[model samples]
Target: MNDATTSPADSALATRGAALDLLFNVLAKRVPFDDAWDASRPLRALEPRDRAFVRMLVATTLRRLGQIDAAIQGSLNKQGQQLKAVVQDILRLGAAQLLFLGTPAHAAVDTAVELAVARKQHPYKGLINAVLRRLDRERASILAEQDAGRLNTPDWLWLSWRKTYGTALTRAIVETHLGEAPLDITVKANAAAWAERLEATVLPTGSLRRAAGGQVTELSGFDEGGWWVQDAAAAIPARLFGDLAGRDAIDLCAAPGGKTAQLAAAGAQVIAVDRSEKRLVRLSENMARLGLGARVTTVAADATEWRPDAVVDAVLLDAPCSATGTIRRHPDVARLKSEEDVEKLGRIQSRLLYRAVDMLKPGGTLVYCTCSLQAEEGESQITNLLYRRPEMQVVPVTADEVGGLSELLTPDGYVRCTPGHLAEIGGMDGFFAARLRRVG
Candidate 1:
């Protein structure tokens, strides 16, 4: 009955337990879900198939956490007796598998009890079994009765979205977050060729999107380094520059450098800088893989404090912000980020933008962007920057330049891609990018 029984199924159950542990790290300890995943010894021991399953278990649990909790509370009655934390996480893992991931009821319940017993919460095994069994049996009715979007989203994010995008769009945005995002990649050349080979669709924004999920590293062109994974929306900021051939550009705060690769692909002599040496190492590795290391120079320095030797022809400042726009891909953002975090990030963004402006040559192009939905970090940041520096003006992005993604363009010509914009195409991450020209 114990996990050490050496059965293949029990070995699989251990993967589910690992997922629950990751959930505790994110929800209770406030560690980034990805960081927890990266540090998982259990995951490394599993085959690639089971490793993917563990990732699915954690992501599905977080993405539907509110609904899972509501289901638990409903099963427990209105009395409000709280279960122990470990027991609750085990139950959530079971519920997610049953209700959302098409796991059979018996397997779901059995795994919940097994994980509970394994983790020394044997006292709650019977209770967990009862609740999960009830939930599985009534999964349809329970799910239908709930307002999943409202229940799943934290209140602060809900209010922020409503205030910034209004009620209708806010609902749409949250609805989109419930779905999994497709894999999008930017190719070194011959996008159409790569799309055909990869069985992907070429997006209007020039990135190829793969809806059928698989191991990205296994895909063609991955080992060859002919392409790199970049979200379709995230690819827009780098493309704002029409031509960077032989031009000098600085990618500030650029680690895990997709944008830097794009700039280098465009023939820009790129100086990619970030404060984290570890991140810079990854960036360098990625650049080497893409055959772009020769075009880029790496520097590990705090972009806020570091300055280029002279003004560059172009500067891409992907400022740090509460990455609220990426909820679909990083469902933990809804649980991990807070309103205070947004305000704090806004100040940091301001400082980075000011420094970016200072580093730009007169008439040099500066692209300021963030994977954030809050106006404080995106629209308002630009407004404040313009008000303070009269010399800089918004350089309107055109529909033609971004492969006809005109709907994502704001009235003032800044590129603002929301989750709702490309819903028909599996949706892209919400992002805001503004190209500015330094006239003074």
Candidate 2:
């Protein structure tokens, strides 16, 4: 092939190489991949298009990690040994492009070989070329008979899901996670009006749905502060507070505040409390863009350690949890989390909920919420809190409060959404929320 035609693919592979090197380095140092991506100074230095390409490769590879690893193994040396993790990442990226992304075989192999040579790993380039060429030859047979679950998830995680959710639900959940998440936005006012302005579709819950990709700031009405990005289900807990006009509301652990904005927009005087100043910086920026900054009181302090000046009319504690519920939108969640981590977060969540109740006014509303699908972090934690705080009575949410989320309510009126709940019309991120009122 001529130099011009060959250069683009070579450049794309180099970008992939840099991204994988960065990913493996961070992962080896025990950094969470999402945090690593956010903290990557090198990745940030690249052009926006190059950054997008690298992010796409990394994200897609991780989403189909199990399959990518399998493909690499199947294309390995006769010794049955795999390449080093760094080289393996390169091969996986190449495999992902060729098999899944439909990039031409010549481009994928040629560029991957070029990348290997550039890295001074020249000897391995022939191996990469041979295996990838073999993969191209056997693409149909390899893909057709492949078991999706075995090829898409780590064995332990797969086994855990099988035992926890049973066969059918686990399969469906895993399959749902494979697709790109839809972009759902919450508007300050009418969803229909904002949808028309943004040229997006309005969902049943009044969230504006747009197909994925694009710079969020470039979208129309973004500069005008017309709406904010929020999962449809995530918008429920704030709404369940129900007409907070002229009320005093405390949003605990409220950094990078979506629910806080929801409250502020509904006319509540909001105290947004969070421990991290860095996170609160983003929250403050969002508030400014949305024009809700004037309504919010930003407090950088731990929720458990810091006491409010006085009791508020309402409290919304969107406690930190395993965050497994957001996996579809953030597939890196799976790579970073473990079951033991979930237990630790559940303990912390329980503590925060108890502290939030102590800060609520007598007979005032307190909404406890988590973006977690695990029962231990959601229902179990809430159930334990109820037993300890008898004066706190469940103030069941009415159908009207949730808009179209009536079907997601528990028998006692708590809100729960899962991968299984809304799979057809663009599934929702899982969440658990309960409304309680202090009786004494």
Candidate 3:
């Protein structure tokens, strides 16, 4: 089903076929890319190398979908618009190969045409072949005129970011999203020692950094549970509560438990609350791997309604948001998330925050955080909370609290880690955390 160069037996055809299905699902059906990726039977059947190819092909197509479509429209003379959605994705995948992955033109064009046949898209094979060939030929010019950062970013997000961080920084954030993020991991202790052993660079926030795209399980520390994968920015919010030893801490919305691990590792008597029971099981499994299960308890209930036996020392609400901040790693978020989604999540985050405060001790700390680049979900939520709850005063994050990076601190004393904050050393995810003290 593929060309001689690609080999009839090579996984190229199977991989692209899977990519098309996943892409069609994500773009047309509005299914999340990760969900689709996980549920894809064909994807699961491939060898790891081919699986990685499928992932990169689909991810690259999603990331540059704007430019790919623009190039397609240009090549199609508006005629290709009549092509089937899957066929369109086929062309998009082909364009991604030619322009981004540096796939050979013959292989890229041939496989695309062949892919159409394999998928019963034979009628549009001509269109697919023509469009991809044109893209391959004009690849240089197509790239030359493209404002990838602008083109790839959704209109709502581009404007929202401009208003929030101004043009230059917004551009930086968009630029950061155009590429893949490096792998960052948080260790239980002796991060420096782990860094030396793994030959990984220790980021300023003390997270270890290495080139991403390897099987995480294959890493040295996976078996020992010495470290777990986490973004440098994600490891920060939990640290805002300093000296958690023997203090009570609640990690609301804590599923898949990255922040929960940090809290328990800090010696906090942690109650990790999440809305999903299934995810709680996963969190418990992770804590066990980290040898932190004894220090943490999992609660599979709505954090707003689930209170501890007594008001705890601190609460960390890593509330759900549109997740625009993770665009670098999950480029599909740029295509999947909307301004309306941000508005909706902001309401939920606020509700969760109000409840988290109720569970805090009189002099306890409450750190509200979100992995959202939208101010509505981060800064605005905190602002409104302070207005409604007078007792919840901002304790303010100092430079030392976040690796002496004073730029991470807001004038109002919150911690705002944008993708552009640590751009020099492979930027971190965008995270907003505000430490508050309930002293009524």
Model 3, span 1-440: residue lDDT tens: 23346654357778888888899889998999989998998887777778888899999999889999888898986754676777778888999999999999888988888888887877787778778888888989989999999999999999999998999999999888888899999998998899987779987778899988768888887989889999999999998888989888889999999999999989998999998998999999999999999999888898767778889998989998888899988888988899788877777887889889899889999998889988999888988998999998999888888888998888988889889988887898999999899997
- Alpha carbon lDDT of residue 83, candidate 1? 82
List, residue by residue over 72-152, the lDDT tens digit for candidate 1. Answer: 889985458788888888888998998899988888888888888788888887799889988988999999999998988
Better by lDDT, candidate 3 or 2: 3
Ranking by TM-score: 1, 3, 2
Supply candidate 2's per-residue lDDT for 311: 92
Candidate 1 — what's its lDDT? 0.90
Candidate no. 1 TM-score: 0.96
| For model 2, the run of ten residues with the poorest summed lDDT | 1-10
Clashes of each: 0, 1, 0
The most accurate candidate by lDDT is: 1
Q: Over 4 Å off in model 3, which ranges?
A: 1-10, 79-82
Better of 1 and 3 by lDDT: 1
Score residue 127 of candidate 1 by CA lDDT: 93
Clash pairs (backbone) in predicted model 3: none
Model 3 — TM-score against the truth?
Answer: 0.96
